[model samples]
Target: MAERAAEKAYYRFLVLFFNCLLTFGSYFCFDIPSVLQEQFQGNLSCPNGTHYNGTGHNGTTECVEGLGMTPEEYNLLYAIYAWTNALVVIVAGFLIDKLGNRFGVFVFSFLTVLGSSVFALGSHFRGTPYLLPLMLTGRLLFGSGNGSLTIVQNRITAIWFKGKELALAFGLTLSFSRLGSVLNFFFTQQFESRFGIQWTLWGGTLLCVLGFVSAVTVSVLDKVGMKQLGLDGVIQQESKKVRVQDVRQLPLRYWLLVLTIMFFYNGVFPFVADASKFIQDKYPGYSQREAAYIAGAVYDSSLILSAAIGILIDYVGLRGLFAVGCAVLTLPAFALLAFTFVPPLVSTIWLGITYSFAAASMWPSIPLVVPQATLGTAMGLATSVQMIGIGLSNVIVGKILGTKSSELKIPLWRWQNMMVFMLANTIACIIVAVSLNIIDKKEGGTLNRSTKRSPTEQVAGQPADTASLLNDVDDERSIN
Candidate 1:
């Protein structure tokens, strides 16, 4: 019993429990607009084409039960989140590396609390002129906090689980974080129906408080583990002052990984942002609630399946090949969504499967290619680039949809046009994934090495040739 009490694996997973909760609030609040699109756009029907004249099915928008924002305004909420993260996350990364992820977690989580509060306030004043501005501000804060919190989470994972179960750890984090998104889609509409919109919005703020408490808990657990393991100095020592030049030192392989995420997520996330409304537009039978459920399949499927794929990638090796295959699959997934009249559930599932596979392979690959000292910076850089792409994509989508809301139903042709853009982005993502595979092979396949192949290896070493991150720096700093 004493032996088990002292086990590092036991404590590590304890920390993982709270680590997974760190970003829950941001994700939960992030997609509120997507699920609430019709109401916010001044329509009162479940299906998009339910034109009512106050008595029956008349050929006019009812405009009774939402905030009445335009389509451009609806999409701008998402754009603000992405844009804020694009500007702030890179700097936040450097600071996390310099100050330590223990503290970084608190800072980012606190930001979420503040942001969510302001957002609730915005919703509270829904009829005022301040509504849009406050909402944008709240999203701005939430985006920065969530984005930086992700950087810290990735860095924390590397610090604690590096060279062992790294991919699985990452998969767990993704599954857990996205659980927030899944819950939002599942419950936001229900909450609004039961307790009114203001209370529903406040619920997100309450979740942010949970996130903050979890952040503090994980930090305490991590510090205790470091002391027990005698690595407090090692962590602090390696996490030294970072320089802007360090960004340039990140390898070409790392940059390629960044490129893969940039193009790939542009297809997935922007779509998720608008998926509920999209489903309502194309499919005739589903209600808004049912459409929200179908849209959330992207996260729900991933929540259940990504950990299994992570375990597979952890043992199977060949992550690059896995990435290539996943990227290629998204092409057909988007094609079916774009051109065919088949049920959208099938395409959503296809997307979720491919996303789970690719994420399990891709994110863990970052620690393999770069030294620990630069991990936070690399993550931040990648996140910033991704935010830029996603933000612009939201804007571009807004432009495509235009500001017309007579019937609240976008034509099938416009839906196809949007899918075409996603398909093109997915094609680029596949090209880059292929490029990443070719480049990784030429460079000794560090990313393709599996831990199962090295049963005798120590926990301190990686699956392949990794730089001696701790040794290169003074004994004063560690990636912790």
Candidate 2:
């Protein structure tokens, strides 16, 4: 029995580790162009275009250094991804539920790798007329895979962690995934500085290949666990097939939660996507390296604290209260970044805290309200809605910032558009979160229960369920 337990433990950790790796490449590659914003926007190649002063700390923004693309073109790279995923994720979710997350993971991971290669290929021919078209094409593919894989991650995570440590597992996965974002911000510049644009991008693409490998490994591990550990019933229960008609059964709170997710994410992710350039435009005195690292703090702080916050919420079970708090905290962060010249680190740290807090709390709440059978479809619907907000936000942001003249020494006006959009979203989030909390209370406080199960609740070392790899955990928890 001890040996059997050890095997289970081993498979569990391995699957979780590889599952976390599945998103690393996608996150890292997503932000590459933003990190190299200057390089991509440059009109001239770096052979003599833009260079560090003799001190190696300051760069001449006066020099145009890379592909001669306008700001609107630069922002299109991100907007395309959001637009494509707004629809694809819903279909992907249904497929995951009908088929299984394991297949979803492998297939989408491959799509990301393919997308990365396409993106790299586009960047390789920097001077060609085809450059922008190729790049946008690449982003479209990448977005489809990235959004779908995220749903897969959530579904599999629900199955694997279930009632116990669900929040922490999410936090850990988030921390690991965001680590890619952090790395891209910090290293993409360094890679470009040493290797030039084409190679640096291809280097990031190589990481996508690694993510695909991890996906393959995780699928194998998941399959092995099912066979060796008697987890077939668990898989069937958690990932049971469902039809579109079943979506009508999702609760009112789920829709509210989806609204909250949509509004809340719009404030954060689009901000991050454009952060590096936003920093340089606001603080012209800083080097690209400084701007990139400062931008990175938004993700770095989350990577450091997300799991710890998850553990706390798991033990205490006040995710709704924390959800409200998370939205509230973001208000000031957006306020400071938009209005004051105060050091950006303060605002970024605040945004990071809120991002980590919500990652731990708001997301795990989805399983509580939605039935297990349709969790995939539910996640898909939420993600589709979330992408709609993000996509529209990106389009708005691109339009506002894209038209600005590159001649300005400091474009202070740049922050206002993002701030107005984010502030409005935060206000919306606060209202929605409050509603979710009130309604959750009326619905018996399902989201407020500690996820820890009593010994009496254990059955076959996993939560028992119906149409739910996720519901069994919910089944054992009482609202009181």
Candidate 3:
């Protein structure tokens, strides 16, 4: 019995380690440009008092300035990633459902590696006319693969850690991914200076390779586990493909949650794309490294906060209320950044906390409102919708910042406009959260209530199979 327990714990950790690896590279590459923003656009230095020439001690401009792209163009690099993700994520999700998690993650990891390679090569395209186009292509490929990674991760996590443990698992997964983002901010710029921009980009490619290797190993483990449990048919059965028309069968709560995800993420990630630059522009006294850390402070905080929030949600079952609270706090967090004299670090930490809260509540709620068979599709659809908002919003903010922008200074009013838009997005998310709460109450109050059956089991109207369900009773008794 002791030996069996030890083996079980080891397998669970192995599965999670690979699952987390799947997104580690994605998150790391996502923030690479932001971390190296100063390297791209040069640094702001105020050596003599609060007013000095904008030129800094940092050496050699990289992509954004080297290519001579406007703030809009620089932002387009980030925007293209989301735009491509919006286009491909749903299809990728469908494929994952059909092909299984292992294959799905493997394919996407390869795409990430190839895309990062192309992106790195594009830096050398500076002398050629195809610089922007090549980089855009690389970003699109990267985004295409990246968009589906999280969905696949969630699907695998549900398969392994369903029920009371699901939320905590997700929180742990998020912390792992956010670790990549945090480390990117901490090290990418330093890497660029010590090595080169190309080497830094290639580092992302290497991380994807590590993720791919882990994924292959996990796939084998998944198969072994299924066979050991005498549930080898479970994966094939769950792959019963979803059709386009079946989307209508998704409950209203699921769609509402989707909208909340779209609006809520738009409020956060678009701002994140611009955050390093925003800090450099607003707080000239700080160095590029200092700005990267501050910009990433929100993500840094999530490393610890997300798992705790997830556990709290699992214990209390106030997913909607927690989401609403996240949205509400976002208003002041952005307000502090936009209008107040409060240090950006304070507002950033607040925003990070709220973002973590929303994420913890939001991800776990998907499985509750949809059948297990459709989990991948639901996650994919949500990601696609959310990425659409993020892509468009990034461009909008970029254009706003680019408007009448001087080489040396960006006026506070331009940033004010961007803040207003973000604030409005959060407000819209709040309204959606309230409506979702009302609908959840009217439907069954499942978001805040415990049950004796998995939502999937209820949806299928079938008795839970002990062999197939992975301790289904424990899962059924909890809500996130």
Name the lDDT value of residue 429 in candidate 2. 95
Q: Which lDDT tens digits does candidate 3 get at residues 69-183?
A: 5577678888999988887988887778777887787788778878888888887666568877888898998888888778888988877766546678889999999999999
The alpha-carbon deviation from the true structure for residue 238 of candidate 1, after best TM-score superposition, in angstroms, is 1.2
Global lDDT scores for all candidate models: 0.80, 0.80, 0.77
Model 2 per-residue lDDT tens digits across residues 371-396: 67788888999989999898888878
Error at 116, model 1, angstroms? 1.2
Clashes of each: 8, 2, 1
Model 1, which residues run further than 4 Å from truth?
1-7, 43-64, 404-407, 455-480
Give the poorly placed runs of model 3, Cα more than 4 Å off.
Answer: 1-9, 41-65, 403-408, 450-468, 471-480
Over the stretch 312-388, how does candidate 1's per-residue lDDT look in tens digits? Answer: 98888888888888889899888998988889989998899999998899888888887777788888988999999
Ten-residue region with minimum lDDT total, candidate 3: 44-53
State residue 249's C-alpha deviation in candidate 3, in Å: 0.7
Estimate TM-scores for all models: 0.91, 0.91, 0.89
Q: CA shift at 474, candidate 2, in angstroms?
A: 15
**Considering lDDT, where higher is better, how would the candidates rank from best to worst?**
1, 2, 3
Model 3 Cα displacement at 395 (Å)?
1.0
